[model samples]
Target: MKKIIISVLLLGLIGGASAYYYAFVYMKNRKFDMVNAEAASVDASVLVKAYQENETSANASYLDKVLLISGTVSATDQTQMGERTLTLSSEDPFSGVMVTLDSAEAAAVNVNDQVKVKGFCKGYLSDVVVTNAIIVK
Candidate 1:
């Protein structure tokens, strides 16, 4: 009985140590620095169309990946977080790609301007959301 209890305690200790290592040490050192990642360059219309046609396949290809997209700005909005969000016009009237940029940077862009943007895709919600966007051109 004592030997069984000791073995169980040893197993528990090993499991706890492994969990701590993964949850704290490993996770704390991980980075999601998408700004510098290699990205797939695409047109805004194509990206929006792909998502609208098949969301699952689109997510697999684009979600969490960095993208460089060129499109005409349809509208710009200032979010509660003070981030500037721009709606890129798509061929489909019902859908578009929403790019979030730093307010200071987005201010330099005006509605109706054609520009190239780089960002991390955050999947869709009526519109595809691309976060941490920077104007590439």
Candidate 2:
């Protein structure tokens, strides 16, 4: 009886310590910086089409991955968080590629400008949202 009780308590302690290490130490240390990360280079139209055709597959492939996309700038806005948000035109008029960048980067972009941008694909709502973006061209 005493041996069984001690063994159970030991297993519980081990499990708790493992959970704490994973949640605090292991996860906290892993970081991917979108600014300098390697990304898949694609056209804005193609990106939008993939989502339109099959959103589930598109999200699996693109979500949380860095993408370098080239397209015409449709609109730009400065968010309250001081980040610049841009809408890049897709071949389809309704769905556009939304890119988020630093205010300084957004300042240089104007509406209808042909540009290349790199950012992390953050899944699609109505638009394909990209965050932590930077102007590459």
Off by over 4 Å in 1: 1-35, 103-107
TM-score of 1: 0.73
Against the reference, the lDDT scores of all candidates come to 0.89, 0.89
TM per prediction: 0.73, 0.73
Q: What is candidate 2's lDDT per residue for 1-137, written digit by digit as tens?
A: 99999999999999999999999998999665656788899899999999999999999899999899999999988678978888999988999999998444644888999989988899998889998788995
Return the lDDT, model 1, position 24.
98
Global CA lDDT computed for model 2: 0.89
Q: Which ten residues in a row have the lowest lDDT in candidate 1?
A: 101-110
Scored against the true structure, residue 119 in model 1 reaches a CA lDDT of 87
Model 1, 7-73: lDDT tens digits are: 9999999999999999999999976554576889999999999999999999999999899999999
